[model samples]
Target: MSEIPSTDEALANLSMPLLDAMMTQRAIRRVKPDPVDDAIVVKCIELALRAPTGSNGQNWEFIVVKDQRVKDQLGKRYRQPWSIYGALGRRQAANDASMLKILKAVEWQVEHFSEIPVLVIPCLRGGTRVPYVPTPFVGETSYFGSIYPSVQNLLLAARAMGLGASLITMPLWNVTSARKILGLPLSVTPICVVPLGWPRGRYGPTTRKPVQEVVHLDQYGNRGLTP
Candidate 1:
């Protein structure tokens, strides 16, 4: 019989892959034909469920779209905002070269969204209608604070499992059509759609503004703490 790995060895092996996953995550729109099995999909959801929720409510739900017909319907609805967004970007790009590149990349993503293998919808257990009256910022933050963590956890878990996914909200702007197509109840509001599948290529390290530039001391604009 093969020798079993010691506990420390097993933990060390697991840590390397987790670190690699965190370092390599990217918003991958293009995917290969390799199908993600139902079991793996379920496992990812299980991992997401472990995420902390407000008051331990665990009020998040996930809808997995595998049917081609439903995917096609979503793809059509997705085109509406995408077109408007593209137009706006094009208008702005005339004055800014960086804007031109960003818009072009977004256009490419929209064109291929429907071809993804699985579309995962993250839904929250709250009515869509928001009160017109002013509400405390804390209340608004508290409400969403419950579910967004779960969403991020799900994406990270997907990356660790060798699957690539991207969070998209273009279709959500047309809430009425999206609700109708998904048969979402009045109490449920769709937050985002994550397209997931095996990636076509390896993701490189993501670049962002250095922490020193963004992080401040006790007060805003205090740059003394910056390294």
Candidate 2:
């Protein structure tokens, strides 16, 4: 196991390579309304480019929206599925104690998504999907696999720079309308919308199930040591 920080100061100044970033990243749903600098956005995109892409076909684009009117319009579309998902999470929270915190956070994000400082929509050029098995699910999942590493890289970079970011894909349920708002061509697919800014609170440790539950040895039944 990785060593825990000795104090809050150590945790606050914490920065490391890839694995430590993965260990500390939390979904920062609420962000201050102050706009992020254009230079920072460019830096984040540059870091994203370093991520490995399937077949090295680096086919991606980012649309950064800071205009209030456009944000309002996109937020309107985002709220549809955000509302539905929040309702489901709320209902589940009544019976599942573990879900209560995130349910409330989702509600807050839905209410203030438009007011968040910056909105980033990541897109993929349509024809470059990595080939996968012919099954429909495989095809879709494979397409996303190619794009998400870059998304994650951007988020991790944001955290490393003390910025907050949350990857929201719920808005894509009405993909046609979203594509129209972004003026994306029919061949371009917007993979996810990311909201980013300075966070209202500090980030610290994150919780997860024991590693043994997910990791296994050479064979399927060979669960590693019970942690």
**Highest-scoring model, lDDT:** 2
Provide backbone clash counts, one per model.
0, 0
lDDT of 2 by residue, 1-227 (tens): 12222233333443556676788799988777876777777777888888877678787888988989878888888788776777777876787776888877777888898889888888888753455835567666766777899999889878777677888887777889888888999888999988887787765678998788888788877896565
lDDT tens digits by residue: candidate 1, 87-168 = 9879877988866865765676677766778988988887434679676788678767877787777777777666667788
Q: Report per-prediction Cα RMSD to one decimal.
A: 5.9, 5.8
Candidate 1 — which pairs collide? none
- In model 1, the runs with Cα more than 4 Å from the true position are 1-16, 90-102, 127-133
- Regions of candidate 2 where Cα sits further than 4 Å from its true position: 1-19, 127-138, 224-227
Best by the TM-score measure: 2
> What does the lDDT read for residue 90 in candidate 1?
96
lDDT of 2: 0.78
